[model samples]
Structure formats: structure tokens, C-alpha cells
Target: MNEQAAEIRKARFGALPERVAFEDMVEEKAVLSANHARDAYDPDGLAVRFSCLAADLGL
Candidate 1:
């Protein structure tokens, strides 16, 4: 039974790679946008948004 399962697993997945590159695993993108710089660092704006979200969730 174990041999049959092993054969099925091997057939389905083929062989595993010994190592994977970081570049192969991730697609890099910008974390911050250029246009929203004015509002991005506003603590009051963040606090208001957080409070709204928490209220919406009844938290």
C-alpha cells in the first residue's frame, strides 16, 4: 500500500528541487505610491480609519 501511494505521489509531483532562488519565489513591487504622500503619514487619518474599522466590526 505504501509503495503504491509512493508511486502515485512521485507520478503526480515528479521530483522536488534541491534549492530554489529568491528571485524565482518573489515578484517585487513598490510598497508606497508617489501620489499619496500627503495623506500617507497622517496619524490622525490612520486613527480615524482604524476607529471606523473597529466600529464596523463591533470591536
Candidate 2:
């Protein structure tokens, strides 16, 4: 019975996985985008420019 069980186990899972301690597994790292700049300036300038453009177009 033991020999039959061993053969069945071997057939089910071809080989045992390489043992890896949990601590040895790769860990996630915090990532942040460095190239992007925050738009901290007020939208007044954009509003003024867009209003002028719209007026010129009679929109």
C-alpha cells in the first residue's frame, strides 16, 4: 500500500518544488513617479486664456 501510494503521489505531482523559505521570497517595494510635476499653480491663468480664445472665436 505504501509503494502504491508513493507511485500515485509521484504521478500526481511530477516533482517536489524547490524549498524556499518565506523570508527568502521577493517582497513588494513602494514605487513613485519621479518625472511628473504637480500642477500647483492656480487655474486663473488657464481660465483667462481660454476665455480670450473663446471670445476670439465668438463662442
Candidate 3:
């Protein structure tokens, strides 16, 4: 990320978790299929990664 984006992120997230860093990088891959059905994304399989930020952030 660039300096400006880093500043914005720091302001929004306070301090990022150890999993994130100013220079850290991650590789991402996604499968693209029928365009129309993509909008109806499902996440049942990824439930373990779900976070209720509303409660965590006291929002």
C-alpha cells in the first residue's frame, strides 16, 4: 500500500493486527464463472472466517 492509503488505514483501524503490515503481501486467487450468478455469492463454507465486527468494534 502507498503512504496515503497507509495513513488512512491507520486512522480507521487504529493499529492493524500482526497479520497485516505496511509492507506485508498476500497472494489472492478467485474463480470467475458465469457473471450473472456471481452477484449471489454464498459463504456457508467460509463461516469460520466470518467476523461480527459490529460487536467487536462496539458499533
The whole-model lDDT of each prediction reads 0.82, 0.77, 0.70
RMSD for each of the candidates: 11.1, 6.2, 23.5
Q: In model 3, what are the clashing residue pairs, if there are any?
A: none
TM-score per candidate = 0.32, 0.32, 0.24
Writing each residue's lDDT as its tens digit, candidate 1 over 1-59 gives: 99999999999999987898988999998886568776568876777667676766888
Residue-by-residue lDDT tens digits, candidate 2, 1-59:
99999999999988978999988998988886564435555576667556676766888
Between candidates 1 and 3, the TM-score winner: 1
Score candidate 3 by TM-score against the native: 0.24
Candidate achieving higher TM-score, 2 or 3: 2
Q: Which stretches of candidate 2 lie over 4 Å from their true place?
A: 22-24, 27-30, 34-36, 43-59
Residue 35 of model 2: what lDDT?
A: 43
What is the overall TM-score of model 2 with all chains considered together? Answer: 0.32
Of 1 and 3, the candidate ahead on lDDT is 1
**Model 1: CA > 4 A from native:** 21-59
